[model samples]
Target: MESDSAYRSRVRSWLDDNLSGRFAHLRGLGGPGREHEAFGERIEWERHLAAAGFTCVGWPPEHGGQGATLQQQVIFYEEYARAGAPATVSHMGQELLGPTLIEFGTPAQQKRFLPGIKNVTELWCQGYSEPGAGSDLASVATTAVRDGDEWVITGQKVWTSLAHVADWCFVIARTEPGSKRHRGLSYLLVPMKQPGVEVRPIKQLTGTSEFNEVFFDGARTAADCIVGEPGEGWRVAMGTLAFERGIATLGKQIGFRRELDAVIGEAKATGAYDDAAVRSAIARACVRLDVMRAYALRSLGNADAGTAAASKLLWSNWHRDLGDLAMMVRGASGLTVGEGYDLDDWQRLYLFTRADTIYGGSNEVQRNVIAERVLQLPREVRQ
Candidate 1:
């Protein structure tokens, strides 16, 4: 086996060669249609990553990974960001469900699903948020009833990112109706191509159907489809959410820093850097960007040590700060869409950042977690 440094260098060299030329056509600011095409191309690019053994670098070699160390995984991501590779399409799977399955899945489940997910052959969407649930995932109203060899599922999941193109969903449903809210939940792997599953696009402020409303009416999965124990869905879901909020956030922060660098370069070229106020603003943005990067690195370290909570208080705050600063720097141009002389990418990012506080648990909820769990503060009283 190659040494870790040798492995990382080899992977870095390969990515530098393979991904550098493919993203030139995708460089400009984009509207919804362009975003769609970019995502499709990204999916193809993820397949190439899988073929090159970079997609699941931390997984064992038997599962189509390179069996790399956690440090190697970090190095790969850093190098990929440095190389300006197009974003991968298997994030929801690779970051969320794949880790969950590896931890909670049976050997048979692992054998059946891991390879497909690793290669992007089966795209997966998260089905935790619903019209009523939102940040309170424990309140999800989706129902799944066991029927001998099958489970009959019915519910509506909103804010399902990429549900239209997803091949499967890791759905959270109420399996025990009258039990405690979190206690009765069960996680099911529901196939989207089944007869009773419907995916309706939800157009965003950017006029893109990047997310969707997924409805499951009498949809069925095998009884064995329950990940982990039947009533243990809450724990499994929390595990997945931890990955969502931690390692995935690290990946995003690294990528966003590149954009922040570009914004700084643009400000300098336009002479905005000379204005005292603009200079101060840019400095503040850079400071917050650095903080975000540091927090992400800390979270990755915690994740590798297996101690990350379902969410972190500092992570959300820094993320919001970074987004707000980028938009503020872009000024009026931040409100426009599509390719323009101005920072239209900043505008798109600004719009999307509104959801950051809400998704992965609202910032309010995260603050509460920190106060009660981390600082040992008194819990707030509410009716």
Candidate 2:
């Protein structure tokens, strides 16, 4: 095995060499509020990453990945983020859906989907959130029914990131009639470009449309598209959610570190660092970031819904607060957009992080998960 330092050096060298010329513009684009920065260019940049064997570093080698060790994966992500690489366009497909497919999908399903993901030939979007179901995921109302060789689906999904650009969507649908809550759900892989599917961009406070409202009216997927058993989709869906909190979070922290450094610089330049309270808030952010890293690293093993919930809760609050601090350090200027809707990075961060606590798992839902699962407390009695 290569030494971790050497591996990180190799990744740095690769990025330094490749992220120039035509791709220089993509260096810091397509992250959380900035997904609209460069549309076509980032897709090409993703394919460029895939061509250089930099895409799926953690999956087993048999499934078109490097089969990297956990430490190696962590190192790669750290180096990638440290290099200021753009937020990945293929993150959902490579990190979440691809791994879930390998774990629960049939050999044929893996063969059909994994290669496309590995090469960035086919992009993916998640279909787990719906109009009536967000964090209460078990309350999925999207319905799919048998149609000989295919499952015809009809439902409305909101807050679906990149649904307009994705080629396929892995969906959680009600497969059995009247089976309430967590039961009767199946995880199905549905195509997104078909006639029955309609995608409308939902503008966010950042004045971007990274999230979409996707409507499936008689949308279809093969009968064999189900990841696990027909009615066991909740299990499969939850597994994919766990993957969301996996090794990539280590890299995410590296981005957080960069943002922190920038904020510290702002404090120093604006004389906010002279204020005792601002200094203390900066110190607190440093400590919380370290704690987040420790939690994420320890979370690599034994990832269940409870563990995933904890990780999400920890990072969500920290990041959202960091955004709040960004505004505080910048004083009054951070509130205004530059010339119409063009926002500076701090302005974008401030607006975007407002939804951070609400998107992945709402603060209320995260609290509920932690209360019921990790703490083993009494469940909330619903009226």
Candidate 3:
């Protein structure tokens, strides 16, 4: 058996070697608020990664994956981030849905779906958030009624990242009539290219349209596409959300590290480092980043009752503050953009991380989760 150290070294070598040549240009290209950069090139780069069997390193061996250990998985994410590899286009497929299916989907579903995810043959988008139910996922109103051999779906999902480019969407919909909240829900893998589906791009503050509003009007998939039992979609969806904050985010922390390094350097270059206040802020950011990484590594497999909310709260608040600091360091200059509404990287970072505390799990929701689930104070009674 290869030691974790040996595997880590091997991963580093592969990244150093492969991220050269044609792929060299892709490093540091795509990420948050800048998903529109080098779209085709990044897709190809991810395909190259898939060919090398490095895509789903954490999946079990039975599932055509490397079956990497928890430590190795963490190492892979960290090294991959350190290499400045662009954010993966297949992340939703490879990270969230794939693991969810492996745990809850039928053998036939896994056999049919997992390969496309690994090989990047078919891209995926998450259809969880709707205009009516973003953080309150249990209140989803999407409907998937049985129609002979297929489930006809109808609903609108908002803030769907990359739905405009996805081949499939694993959706949570009301399966049984008269059921509300978490009941009567089912997880269905609906095809995105059907006649009933409409994807409209939503332009964000970053001057990029990485998110979309997807309308599903009678969109259909095989009735067998349901993951887990009907009305048990809530459980499956929650499980998938658990994986959403997994090792992949560890790599994201590395990106955060680079951004901090850049901000520190920017502070120095702009002579903001000379200010005692700026120096104090930069030092504080450095300390918080180290704390974030340590907490992330320790909580990779964290199954503590309400600690998930704590983890989300910790990082999101820190990132939002980092963005604020980036803008603060730039002073009035950060408020302006280049020609054609084009934002500089820091400008985009500042603008985009505005939602760092809102998306995934909103800061409000995280606090509620901690208050209700962990502290047992009292769940906010949703009207």
Give each model's whole-structure lDDT. 0.75, 0.90, 0.89
**What TM-score would candidate 3 get against the native?**
0.98
Tens digit per residue, CA lDDT, model 1, 1-383 = 67878977897789767755665554332322234757777777778878877787767777667776766777777777666666666778887888888889898888888999998899999999999898778788999998999999999999888888899999999999887668889989988998999999986755567788999999999999989888899999988877676545555556667767776787777766777887787687678767766756665646421234333545555555656766666667666565542335656566666666676677677666667777778987744
Q: Which parts of model 2 have CA positions greater than 4 angstroms off?
A: none
**What's the C-alpha lDDT at position 188 in model 3?**
90
Tens-place lDDT per residue, model 2, 241-272, is 88888888889999999999999999999999
lDDT of 1 at 313: 48
TM-scores of all candidate predictions against the true structure: 0.89, 0.97, 0.98
Clashing pairs in 1: none
How many clashes does the backbone of model 1 have?
0
Candidate closer to the true structure by TM-score (higher is better), 1 or 2: 2
Ranking by lDDT: 2, 3, 1
Error of 2 at 22 (Å): 2.0
Better of 1 and 3 by TM-score: 3
